[model samples]
Target chain A: MKFGVIVFPGSNCDHDAYHVISKHVGQPVEFIWHKETDLSGYDAVIVPGGFSYGDYLRCGALAKFSPVMAAVKEFAAQGKFVFGICNGFQILCEAGLLPGALIRNKNLHFICKHVNLKVENSNTPYTSEIAEGEVLSIPIAHAEGNYVCDDETFHQLEENGQIVFRYCDENGEVTDEANPNGARSNIAGICNQDRNVLGMMPHPERACEVLLGSDDGRNIFRSLTKAIAAHG
Target chain B: MKAKVYVTLKPSVLDPQGKAIHHSVELLGFEKIADIRQGKYFEIALDATLSDAEARETAEKIAKDVLANPVIEDYRVEISN
Candidate 1:
């Protein structure tokens, strides 16, 4: 199976994702430029982290209108895997592939550190290999990582098992203190109702190697690859 | 004609930057402040061929779709010479 990593104008982590997918996930991957509109050959698409459109107007607002985003939207509608990390997560939300919006961090700080995340749901393809309640040490670096939505939408996400990962402590306890950003309900990641599109603030691409700090991030990619291969 | 747009966060969304500014003002001895919120302002120049009503409609559409995210913000449009 082939994987595609999208490269926006300001995307700095495109190569990182490409390397991880090739070396760690043992998959063939290519860097897809922002202007590219075709995605038929790739089994999954990854939107790597970085400030797209220089994060103008809002974090992901401008990038949502990019030419490739229209294709990404249609890809998600076909139940293909689309994973967005950090700014990519913001872009997915802005593009309406996912629900809610990411706002400025509550403390108004560009926090960069390794935070623990509890797997809230493992049924989705992104987290199928991870056991529910498993805590992953993943790094998050962003100034606007706070996620917010209205009450009704929040309820539907809750009722649909769409919540995939939640900020938590070492022992897997969800708490405000563990929430690096003031995201409602300590949400760290979520999937669409169909569970095909997944967005998270954590940079899994940066944590794919033990030399870097943790290899826990590999589980997410591993899960996706395994699920895709099994389906074929 | 010139169209002005005002965009502000909805009351339900927290404005951390505005809060920090409020705290700074309190430290500056401005004791009468109840609260503070931050917002954005934009000005658009429209072609004269469009009527005033048409300008309003165009400005409102821009404000709704491009200038503001209705999920967490409210926008107002004003038209003038």
Candidate 2:
């Protein structure tokens, strides 16, 4: 499936996401500028990580107003796939594609490290290839990854099975120590109600190669390919 | 006209940056402080032709829609000529 990577002015990981899709995933991908308002040609759209608009006002706050975001909202409404990583996840949250907001890290420091994430709902399109309760090591780099939401919304997310991944220990145990950024209930990733959109704090693109530390993230792409092929 | 906006996190949500600053303040020997919460301030310029009520309304709308995420923040708008 063809993928389009959304590139805002300060997006640095757009190239990384493009490289992973083309070189590793062997899929055709293109960079779509934030100002462009079209996304009809792509089967999937990826919002890659970076400090869009220099993180002014708040992270991803300024980025939600970019013209492309309107197109993205339309694309997702049509049930098209949308994947967001790290800052991309923040953008999606700010754009209201997903519930909850990422706040400052509990320690008030920028954290960069590899953390284990347990696949919470493997039946979804993004995690179909991953087994439930399986842990994948992925690196996360950010200062505002602390996810928060009101009690009612949190219950809705839980009851609807919208949560896709959660921080866990090596043994696949969900614990406070494994929560690198103090995300609520150790959440690392989540999908929209329709399951067509996903936003995660971990950088799966950066973990697609064994040479770079882990290749476990490749399963996410493989899962998408399988799902699209089987249903499309 | 100038619009001054103040955005702050909701009381229920945690504010790690503000908490860190509070701890630092305590380290500096300041005690008896109840709590601390951090927020953002913005100054927006509007056309002079707009009336006071119109400017306040515009400022409130922007402050609600753009300057803050209502889900997690509370914003106050003050207009000055």
lDDT at position B71, candidate 2: 77
Model 2 agreement with the true structure over B1-81: per-residue lDDT tens digits:
999999999999898888888999999999898899999999999999999999999999999888899879999988999
Q: Give the per-residue lDDT of model 1 (tens digit) for B1-81.
A: 999999999999999999999999999999999999999999999999999999999999999878888888999999998
lDDT at position A122, candidate 2: 90
Q: Kindly report which residue stretches of model 2 are placed more than 4 angstroms away from their true locations once superposed.
A: none
The collision pairs in model 1 are none
Query: Each model's TM-score?
Result: 0.98, 0.98
Which ten-residue region of model 1 chain A has the weakest summed lDDT? Answer: A223-232
lDDT of 2 by residue, A1-232 (tens): 7899999989989998999889988988999999999898788999999999999988899999999999999999999999999999999999999999999998878999999999999989899998999999999999999999998989999999999999999999999988888889998999999998999999999999999999999999889878767756
Chain A TM-score for each candidate, in the given order?
0.99, 0.98
The sequence of per-residue lDDT tens digits that candidate 1 reaches over residues A1-232 is 9999999999988999999999999899999999999999989999989999999999888888889999999999988899999999999998889999999999999999999999999999999999999999999999999999999999999999999999999999999999988999999999999998999999988998889999889999999998778756
Assess the local accuracy of residue B20 in candidate 2 as a C-alpha lDDT between 0 and 100: 86
Candidate 1 stretches with Cα past 4 Å from truth are: none
Interface RMSD of 2: 0.8
